[model samples]
Target: MQVAYDYEYQLAVADYWQGRPTMEPNVWVPSLPLQMTVAVPASNTDLVVSSGGQQELKLAVMEESTEYQHERSNPMEDFEKAARAFEDDLQKMQTKMHLFPPSMKGEELSKYSEPKVVSIGPYHHGKGEAIPQMESTKYAAACHFINESGRSVEEVYGAVFAVADEARRCYDADKLRLLSDNDFKPMMFYDGCFLLQYMLFMCRDNNDEDHPIADLPWVVVDKLMKLMPKPGLDMETFVGRVKQCLQTRRHLKFDPPILDESYKPPHLLGLLRFYIVGSTDSSTTDDGSGQGLSDNAKKVSLSVSVIELAEMGIRLTADKTTAEINKMRVTRGWFTGKLFLPPVSLDDANARFLVNMAAFELCITPDFGEVDDTMSTVCAYLCLLGMVTDNDTDVQELRKKHILQGGGLTNEDALELFTGLEKHLRPGNCYYNTIVAIENYRSDRRLWIKLYRFGYRNQTAIIAVLTTIAGIAGFLGTLKSFQ
Candidate 1:
């Protein structure tokens, strides 16, 4: 009998050999009378089948294909999972209080960026050697805060616990895996209450006998005061005072607008950043047309130093309109230009405050949509200061214009601080616009600036030449008269 090898026959054969029943009963035979003889040759084995007469049968060898097929999966489901993960990451980035980035992790930068007296959020909490000393203070402040609110401790703590899960999402998951809800809830509650009480203590008169500050150690008070505003000031004045103390404002001539009652901050440091940088609305600059700069406008670059600007007939002045960092701009006249900068007072406290704020900005992901500017307002302001200040002489010039106010920092210190900070700052829209305006002014008066810079550089030689020429003309006139 001759058998044709086909797909069905191959499948049947495979199923029979594998001990699997075939789907078609008629296709498989359980018992068939047959005789088979196998012959082993040098190159291959041969099988001969004989019923009445012997017949030789040859087996065809098949090569296996090296391809594979996987089970089908739902693409939409995978896409949705990926999209959800991406959104979660963005939310975490926006709401989370982040630690200093690797770039800002050196001993010098970390000293200011990390909390020295106390840790406010999960990022720094329980990590520092000195932080444990403030645990008692936090408890005391929480107790005071609860009493001041006229709420029971359980009620206040329950409120924090209710939002505890939401708050936990703001911190890194790896850091929080070891922290249980039992430990985390109290942390948020105590930290929140302590921060509120601290702010209240800073803004109100300190004579209250039951105040948290009264119980705090003198060393702690001194350190805390460095990060806080002076006591006995109203809310607006308190904001301005803190802004000045932190060197957040170019000048404290104008008070910041009162924080809205509806506004909520992520943490204590966030609240301080708000007080320093002001609201996003206040930070947004308005051109005469009430529109922001075009993309092209924000790409402009400025390289001139403060001294070079002065030589080009451009002077630095403090912006008295507002304490917002975005208030920086340049104005031009027919013969001169003026760069208006927000005034700032630099000191140890201010340096710490500024560095922390800059680090906060650095930690924030650009996808947060917190502001239209490409960089944070504080960082942009620092970058602008860095651009104009190259040396101690530039700091002196800034002080002369009252743009740099009196602080514990000397001119050299201020220069070093700005130089250290500006490297970490990316240009924001405000800084870029200021640069655009300055560049435009420089370009418009290119010829005049060039001539002025040349004349200014060679002024002594030019004056000496003029004096010699005058003497030569006078002697020639005298000689002619004698002749």
Candidate 2:
């Protein structure tokens, strides 16, 4: 810790004898590792910077990139501002509008990937609740990335279900029931997403029962029937890729194994068109990049009935613009001078909300229903707000496709953050109705059938006889007392 005074004297003498250039005082002193009692400025010059915990030293010369800094435009800041604007506008316009309906169209909507649906294997270890727990920075980054990137139409997204499967759980019993039902897959756009089943578990009344629906009948997308070859990697291989991400700070070398194009779902196109491509901030910016779309944009929706393939459904309707689409039909060897107009006029914001809601419904279908109270309330709002269509196949398909398995927040997350979830001071948060739904489900007949199933007939008859005898005895006693 102690430095000899002779060292400083020797250095001064050497500098004088050699007639060497003076060393910059601001540069780190060679006396750095020493302990100091009386504080001496590191630099002889007034301008100095503070060292780790020591006094700032003065330096006439500075190292590169040390002092001056440059300013750069933050694309993320721009995106966040835009997103906030959108949220504000939507809240102002959509607050009072009902978005979820109790009962929606229930007809079987067709799918483009019909032939290739694969049944998830029995060994499928369902995942936990997929509640997004992103911090502010991460949220901004995700929003920025999504807003700036191009949509990928055919790629299957990967979302590992946690053991709790929080993605799909709702607070309403009816919604929970609808979601957990095995037969509801057809209601969804795809055979439901990764945590679709698990969300059902999260939304279930766990407090009342271990509500993961203990006995499940595995009904899956029949992929083998659809002509798609299986991915070479199984769960073990997929886990290995996950391991790589954990092992290194960089991106994993292993990419998701590509599946055959033949088996890709047609809904994937619509997914890309709307979710991935539709709302990007950069796309709408005037960058001459063909990234932005007009406020009003329409996506093509295709539907085929499992019961009747000929009865096809398309999300787009025929209107004057239809003529425009027809005008460009020369490639099909068809001459069309008319325009292709959509039935729903997307010029207005309300119309866009309606269409987007419809698309959401189509994609989110039988995928979620009979959900928990919280989720049920959300779905109900979607209906009450008129975002979802009335009871029918096409309408039902839309609900299944869009809303139920809503990805970002699972039922538990909704419950945990239930107090803080709403960012606004507006009334009628979807959570209120969810509680009502839970109370209602508790009284349902099925809740106690198992426990009271023992000797039902005999017990009922005996109670009935005892009640009659007691009534007669009371009548006789009253008469005697009157006498």
Candidate 3:
């Protein structure tokens, strides 16, 4: 006889039997049919059945209960998997070229942040009508680059194709989904070849008359040159030149470390940034600030401008050794203070490169595995410039000291550039250290600064008082002599 119990009721009865205390054998239930026989073992409360029908029903209930429990726990498992995928996506995004930040968007900043002459990476590849015209130039550059490399075009393209998947991940996923592998591989191959050829052409000592990019507009060439590696005679000389360029102080005897052999740059821009900022030491603290500094020290504010620094007997001087941002520092002497800054030429090309570098640093996330704040070296440098430059007078002061070489830009324009950039940049460790050093110097020589300010503000009055006192003293001396 078949039992007319629902699946839920069967499960409930199974659970009740499993939870019950030890019971006598052959426990009969009034709910069962007359032909059905139930045996309950004394050692366990599990239902034991001699009939095949009862046994099959009990096994089905056990399997369903296990499945129900698994389904109940599935939400947490799914959530955990999604979280892992999200983290992985963020990590991949860090290596890609980032778009201009919303905070930095403005007509004044557009010239600096956006690519004007040519687009090197995927972020601005084909957005403009005029941009696609450069595609022919890129193709020519690729042909020339391949010819120079002494490698077959097939081999070169194959190499790029091999890494095309990784390269594709360095862009917005949504934008990339619209592009097929066929379209993407050729873009990578062409872009890579063009950049290599351009850098090689610009970095050479003798300009070849037949170079593919020689006929480009001067404005375009100039902008591209600003981003190219500095010219060196050979590989050894190039390393030395880069090392020398990264050294912050001329006579300080401190040498900036070179990039490690194993450190592969994600792209040409990343390599350029490495050269500009120098390699970050892995020994840096988790916060990306160097060790031995307290939180309070890094939090110190710098409100003094270039003019105010000069008024307080602090002189601004060009480093003259390197243009690396990490080299800025403040030194105090017995009677005066000096702020040493890397001199920069603020032209259109240099301004564009610097602003894009700053924007790139701003896009770097903390999960990128390097010191997040350390990457903001350009931003910190700009913030320092903004802090010191408030008006044309401050810009003039910086120019006078040879710290700022304003190429084609007037004092007002330079002031405006720094003012526009400084508001969006967060100070990095270098800026924090410079400010802390200045604050420390101010604290150490508080009395001297106060006295100097007092004397400076009343210099004419003090001079008059001294002259009158001298006259009175001379008269008293004459009277004493007569007596």
Every model: Cα RMSD to truth: 22.2, 27.0, 21.8
Tens digit per residue, CA lDDT, model 3, 1-483:
343321221111232334445433322221122233336544423455665646422233334576666665568889999999988877765466566788788666766665656666556766566666777777677666555555544445556655666666666778667665545555565666666565565444423121121111122222223333345213332333333432222444434345566655555455556676754443222232333444334344556776567656778888775566666767667788777887876666567767877777777653223565467678878888898888888888887888877455788878888999988776666666666666666655668888877887889999999999999999999999999
- The weakest ten consecutive residues by lDDT in model 2 span 324-333
In terms of lDDT, model 3 sits at: 0.60
Query: 243-281, model 1: which lDDT tens digit per residue?
Result: 545343343245455777664555545555666665455
Each prediction's TM-score versus the true structure? 0.67, 0.17, 0.67
lDDT, model 3, position 448: 89
Cα displacement (angstroms), candidate 2, residue 167, comes to 3.1
Candidate 3, residue 373: how far the Cα is off, in Å: 6.0
Deviation (Å) of 17 in candidate 1: 80
lDDT of 2: 0.26
lDDT of 2 at 76: 100
Candidate 2: where is the Cα deviation over 4 Å?
A: 1-165, 168-483
